[model samples]
Target: MKRRTFLGSVAAAGVGAAVAPGLLAPAVAQAATYKKRVTGADLDTNSRWQVAGTDLGIPYVLENGSIGYLFGDTFNSPWPEQQNNDWRSPVMLRSAVHPGEAGGIVFDSAAKVAGNGRAPEIMHNGHNGIGIDNLWEVTVIPNDGISFPETGRQLVSYMSIEHWNPGPRYSLWKSRYAGLAYTDNGNDFVRTNLKWFNDADNADPFQMWTMQRDGDWVYVFSVRSGRQDGPMMLRRVPWEQLFDPAAYQGWGWNGSNWGWGRPCSPILNGRFGEPSVRRLGDGTWVMAYLNCATGNIVTRRANTPDSAWNNEKIQVTFAQEPSLYGGFIHPWSGAGANELHLMVSKWTHGPAGNSTAYHVSQYVGSV
Candidate 1:
């Protein structure tokens, strides 16, 4: 079937609703929820160790003999707690060479503030006072590279939504904003200046994924927000034009559409976030993300990154715990074989508490 027609049929049937070529509509909309939950019950939960203490935001990079993760320690407490714990404002980067192995580079700053108090400059705000977190990098094999600076560079501004409480008169509005930047040292590494990818007013910037189709040029995918629906909006932008002021002027294609009834309609009422995309063997793109409402990890596939994606959403991991974050796929992990791995952090009772312990799972068969 043509891609567009397939998508139209899928949307008409409702998310996860099965369809027949010409069957009668059901008396009610199929339950827009998953029936099962996946959690860490039988696995060796104690095997995974903490990469850093006191920091929440985490992004990883895996390559031959090495795995790197970057995170920051700045805590954005809501109005009440903000009065006390104001000292937790340092950012850091760390890595491990082997899969379960551990070791890494740490970068910290002498300054501390709610927003980092730095000027907003650079791609997402590279030079701005915003704390640096949510890191991702592309690697060139044969020779691995990793380094850290005594004084880390400021990348973006972020606010934590987990810190707020809502009242009848005052609504809860919490979010994180990032400015992107990269640099080339006339040698191996090139750093691009940060650009404003988000504003401090709305939702927080959760995680970002990037893919390079041809060469030199790159495209970025981010999990932003739609406040009312509460689902993360998946957005994409070209690397070359990312830093331009006008780049944010018009909406560029990022696979899904904004409102209801479109091919790119928000799934599971918008609570999805932490998205990671991988090109399948057939050249189709598959995305795995957190289904917040059901607290399960689910998978969705698309013929292309732009439009006409499959409406049949599949639940991959059935974690019973509060599984809200961490979804990733490592394409180069096995020899000539693609492997899918997913992680879910355990639920926390409060902002200062640790994330639920994480659980990782591999795909059952080849894609």
Candidate 2:
């Protein structure tokens, strides 16, 4: 099992013991009301046409009103194997099922992969396998992606990893830098020239990102790669200047007042992994992620993206599911309803590869 998974099992013994004393106050109420598996082996979504098993089910609304899920490290093989896993680091899956509908979110097919498709990767990651160099990038993993409102242009943020080292948690992957890629037709993506952040700065907070749109501005939440012992940062840019790297301004405090500017500061301090932030219909902002300290998936709400995240931290998943991560909020959730559905990924590491439980799951929470 992975280090995080092992910690999760240990945390399951007692959530209170896993978490630091006084790190968080008691939750006012439980956020997770219902839970079920959405996609994986033996589920309805597993097949040759779409995802059999994958991770990072990051969701965003498309221009056509359908929901698009950005997945990482997908496999066409129904059962986990060491080789010939039909590997695709990044792939796109589309679904028309509404969150409020009776059945859970069901993926229809791949975005670009055609008939009898095997869920082909939408983006390029240079060459496959380890010890191979195809210029500066060896393997690029998609973190989070979103579609523009009017233009419908797709933008995804990714990390360029130099290599993956075996044994240990923090040293698992050595990332060179993080950058952005855009696609107008949804099939071909062009990597931008600007580097969002590099690994040279040990404390850079933009290594992982999750983006959401609010009116004329788009809000981005970021954390480090290891997803532990780091602070979450906030940034926003105008919709018109979406592709302009310099247009983004970070939220920071100077021991006096909080404002938006360069060199963003931490909005919340904790162990975070794969954060998901979305604006509710009533303008309330909800953020969800795997809290490594407590070994539980949690959600916190704030009035604004730059506001203090002092609200009650609601636990969305039980302490037992330690291998779970990637809490991507459904776009259509909480628009005019009281329930919010989140797409969460769960996987157990195996010597052959990933176990059959490796797939995306759903958790319904009260808004």
Among these predicted structures, which one has the highest lDDT?
2
Error of 2 at 76 (Å): 1.4
Candidate lDDT (C-alpha), each: 0.31, 0.68
lDDT of 1 by residue, 103-135 (tens): 212222111112223211111212223333443
Candidate 1: worst 10 consecutive residues by lDDT? 1-10
Model 2 per-residue lDDT tens digits across residues 159-237: 7765543223332344566778888887667778757654553446788888888889989998876554567788999
Extract clashing residue pairs from model 2.
none
lDDT (Cα, 0-100) at 64 in candidate 1: 23
Off by over 4 Å in 1: 1-67, 72-173, 181-217, 225-238, 247-269, 280-284, 312-323, 331-338, 348-367
Q: Give model 1 RMSD, 1 decimal.
A: 12.8
